[model samples]
Target: MTAVLDEAIKKASITWVSVGDGPAYALWCMPVESSLIVVTGPGEQHAPGLTSAPTATVRLRGDHGGLIVTAEATVTRLDHAGEEWAEIAPQLAGKRLNASGPAAEVVARWAATGCAIVRLTPAEGTPVTAPHLPDDSAAAPPRETPARVETRRPFRLHRVRPPRT
Candidate 1:
């Protein structure tokens, strides 16, 4: 199961994570050693309650885009001034697409803004996989946000014509 979990994490570009019973959030993750790294804060992705939570449930997708595995992970926040950050931050920045600037600059900005770099280490146990998976699709309604389309409908191009004789 460990091998399977590791391979899934490596192949996955994004993973769904839910802390406690909160809604799962899709976060861009990088497989670092045996753990997955995710960044969240003002300028990065927003994963509410993740930084404060000690454990989280992670769902990885397979090649067919279905849920492949679900595992419980131990969460650890990296200290920006620590050596772990010194080594991992650059790698994460490089993997980050559409970064505002170079890797070094991006790392600097994240540190300055106090972004949370979270590492999720999959716990050793029997992960939910294969035939044991749920039968129904776990789809949920979209969360409400302030951003929405408020524009009126567009005008018709052609005018209505009178009935033909």
Candidate 2:
């Protein structure tokens, strides 16, 4: 299944939420890094409130004649404890790729605000993609790769607060 996730990741749009000072923003890569995923729509949800991180879980599927893939993703804003936004601003533009459309727009916006792209760190028991199942075996399930969100040290735009009042 890991291979499927990898393939999905390749087709997956890296998305992240920016939370802290102002209104939260949900930005997705739109097929994420490669050519846009045609036909399907972007499964973005409503925005997040202040002091909360907006999250988006996207399902990516790729079909090339016979191959099919499916993956689930949850993107969140990393809350840095007492870290100033300025420190992470510079890294945002660095992650921008030359691709156009939504991703380019997100990068442009992040670049403008000096916001960095947050990496998606899969949590324990998170789902990952793997190689496709054998076409002949209708009863067999698709294989999964051994991939997990090791650890994510995402740059944040706001300071993390202690327990809320």
**Quick one: best lDDT, which candidate?**
1
Model 1, position 66, has a per-residue lDDT of 95
Q: Can you give the TM-score per candidate against the true fold?
A: 0.92, 0.32
Candidate 1's TM-score: 0.92
Candidate 2 positional error at 43, Å:
19
**What is each predicted model's overall lDDT from 0 to 1?**
0.91, 0.38
Candidate 1 C-alpha error for residue 30, in Å: 0.4
On a 0 to 1 TM-score scale, where does candidate 2 land against the true structure?
0.32
Q: lDDT by residue for model 1 over 1-165, one digit each (tens)?
A: 467788898897899999999999999999987789999998999999999999999999988999989999999999988999999999999999999999999999999998989999988894788888898889999889887767997888998799999
- C-alpha root-mean-square deviation, each candidate: 2.5, 20.0
